[model samples]
Target: FHIELPMSLSDLVRLCGFRAAASPIHCRASSPPHSLPPAPVDGLDESLLADDLGAMELELRHRDAYLRSLGSPSAETVARSTLVTDSQVDQIMASEGPLDRLKDLYALNEDNEPSYELASVMLVSMATFTYLNVRYTVQERRLAGVSFEERNKLTVFASKQQASRRKMDYITMRALRLGLKRSASSLIFAPLFLGGAQCISAVRGRSSPLDFLPSGIAAGACVRGAHGLQPMLGGAFLGGFLGAVVGTVVYGIQMYCGLTYEEMRRYRLTERSERDARLMAKLSAAREQA
Candidate 1:
């Protein structure tokens, strides 16, 4: 009796010079099976093919997620996950105008520290003072019939006198002292007003249009308390009136805008996300071209 083996197995046995005493082995005489007709590549279902491709993409995403969990993601994974490249960030920062930068600097969030509020207020105060000073200086010079060239000469002379003999013109000295006083007042009042407003808001449990009135009154009373009770009372009344007017105007604007603080914040976030998406698409196209 003979047992037939595949040709390849028989050849392996022959090459190794192995023989089984129980039965003789012979190579099968039949030809090798032909490979199945390559799965009919021409008339395949397009929808089924698309579904398969989609499944493959999902599987790749899962694989990338797994790799990320292990903290050893591939370069391709990192590239796909990144929102923006370093160059893109640089371009965005460069494209920002001064006004945009200034807005960003002054922008405040609920989570921000008191120091941030203080700094923002200080900046506003400084800007106010600068504008007022410039206007005052121009008006005074005009009233004195001082030409631009003459003013420049006086400024130079004042600087020279101060440098050489520690003496400055009386008008220049007075202006300098006034600026210093205003700056000092700003430093003191900014914190007082901000703290009072925050305290009132916290006590109220929510903000209201009238929240500023008491805060302003307290701030004003403190500012004028050094003079007398009458002055303090007058200051408080004035402050409360101003605060109420400001609050009313602000509330009216909010009503007109048809959006609350939360809505505005969400809108800004949505806009930022859309902008980032556009930038990302542009970057991807550029990468594909490269």
Candidate 2:
């Protein structure tokens, strides 16, 4: 009739169907250290291993993409990587003989075409002035209440006339500028350089040779350090010679440019004549038919 005996915890757990789970703690407390969940039987975790491998593959893919985004090398980079050393460049430059080098320097190829450059510069300057003249002329006509249709009709003729005048102005300006520059340089620097050379020769106990430098006499006068008519004579002679040389050079350049300009002008005139002739012929034919 009294209360029943208290059930043990293990027995209570067993009654609750936790016998297998509870058995491990009991076994672990009493079992030897050599035992541990049967060593996982397969000794590997398939799901966990697959997760690690997938992470590794993803990391590898990210690394490859990052590398690919850095593009290929450029020309400069290639050049740096395959650099030509100074010694190699020197060797290449020195491969040519002295005579070959001199010929290369003086060769009349495209690179050495100073005349072409001069012509191009002259042409550009002429064009610039012509553009400015034409613009102002157009502006003036507009301000004078010229109608758009009439202005457009006259534009071609005005531009051509302005261009012709500018071409002549360009040649004249170039000649004056070149003449002044050459003459001034000859009068000033030539004497200094030539006189210094003469002094050097005198110091070397050698009589200065009478070279045909345009400013040599003037330079010689300065070098002579004399106090009489001799200095004046030397200076006058030098000035004349330098003036002549400078004049010759300037004249040559101007002549070349003038000839070129005249040739172009004649060609243009010829073209205009031909055009007029054709127009006249057409008009005559039309009049006869009428």
Candidate 3:
């Protein structure tokens, strides 16, 4: 039913005949251009949606598994996992082989037992690498014009700490922290046997020796006018050997002694000569400030 309205002449004509006035203003006033509504309150992006979907799916599976476990597991477990895209799992499968190989090689009867052989190898390797690192650090300090007294004190302090801490640490915890990381420092260890083999085999090709060693054993000291000869080769070997022996003994004792590094470091401080004590005190202060 159409109702007639009492209106102005233009309004009546426009409504009854669907006509516009003789201008653009009349048509625009009735029908303005359309616009979209504002985006949603949730407004989750694609990545976030994927993340939430994954999380929700995991929770649902967990609950389903709990329910299935109450009586008997259904085919749902296999089916849900089967739905996973292959691309999502290729990387996981690729990395799984090494761990499986390790497990098989050790005959891991149960996950609880530690492989003592692997553990020892890892521990000893770490100790040796650290010792080598100390030597390198000393050489660097010397090249940088650091005084001999400074170098000597640093090395001795490091050695003393190792000696003190040798009695009471756990074999496994120490191995874990030191094991994987020490494996990466083959550079220093390689010089004896491979003599730059690792770097040579790298995809990037061999690096300049100076890039790593920095201090040339044949080069002069930093303080040119007042100096001694450069440190000779095999010098590090003596200190390194001592360090390795110390590390092994200490690790063995601590593993067996049930003592800890913390405990050893606690009472390790000793009485020194007045001059030595003052020097150590100064070093300690400098370290703390740094």
Candidate 4:
């Protein structure tokens, strides 16, 4: 007798408890042929995923190292790369003395004009000269009529008498006041004289002795203008005569020495450098001893 099964083959396997007996070919055949297979899940191989993660971490570390190498150097690296060492810097600083500092204060560079240096030099010299002149003139006038013996007698009397002390004090104060006034005037006069002389020299395209005459005359006129016409004339005459004498002397010196202003300045700078070098050597020896 022949019989037909009502259930499917999968149901027959389940009923008969024959799961192991179910064939893969039969299972595949049971499904629709048009359907695709399911995709693989990611966590199937943990070691492979871990290996990939470790490779990415190593690459990131390499990239970070490269970026750091391209960045600015560390402080220690900069210090090592510097041209001047700390001890050399300290020595350089220590080499500059008071005189060097003073020279630096009035230092002239190529960009600076000669007129400025001339004016500064003249101002200092004239101030000293004016003070001495005023003091001498005052003392000379005070002692004009008296003989040498009489002056000695007067000095002795002044030392003994209180009234003479007041007179002596008056003379001293008067001389001081006159010296200060003339020195103050010289501060203004010297700059004007030098500036005017410089301007005249520049316009003429060369220096001349005659350049000082006009400058001195103008400076004297300005200074004495507040006094009177007679005083102004007298000052101008005196200034012109002195200016001419000074010019002649200066020209003579230049001719004798064969040195220009620039040459003199260079010589002075060389001398100063030598002096500074000697000073530096002494300081270095002293430091070594210490």
Point to the candidate with the largest lDDT: 4
**TM, every model:** 0.42, 0.18, 0.18, 0.39
lDDT of 3 by residue, 160-198 (tens): 566335312333333434443444443334332222211
- Against the correct fold, how does model 1 do in TM-score? 0.42
Q: What is the lDDT of residue 144 in candidate 3?
A: 35
- The collision pairs in model 3 are 166-250, 167-254, 168-254, 168-259, 169-254
Q: Rate the local accuracy (lDDT) of all candidates.
A: 0.55, 0.46, 0.40, 0.60
lDDT of 4: 0.60
lDDT-wise, the better of 1 and 4 is 4
For all candidates, what are the clash counts?
Answer: 0, 2, 5, 0
Give lDDT tens digits, candidate 4, residues 82-119.
33444554454456554543444345555574434464
Candidate number of the best TM-score: 1
TM-score between candidate 3 and the true structure: 0.18
Greater TM-score among 2 and 3 belongs to 3
Q: For each candidate, C-alpha RMSD in Å?
A: 21.9, 28.3, 27.8, 30.2
Clashes of 1: 0
Alpha-carbon lDDT of model 1: 0.55
lDDT of 3: 0.40
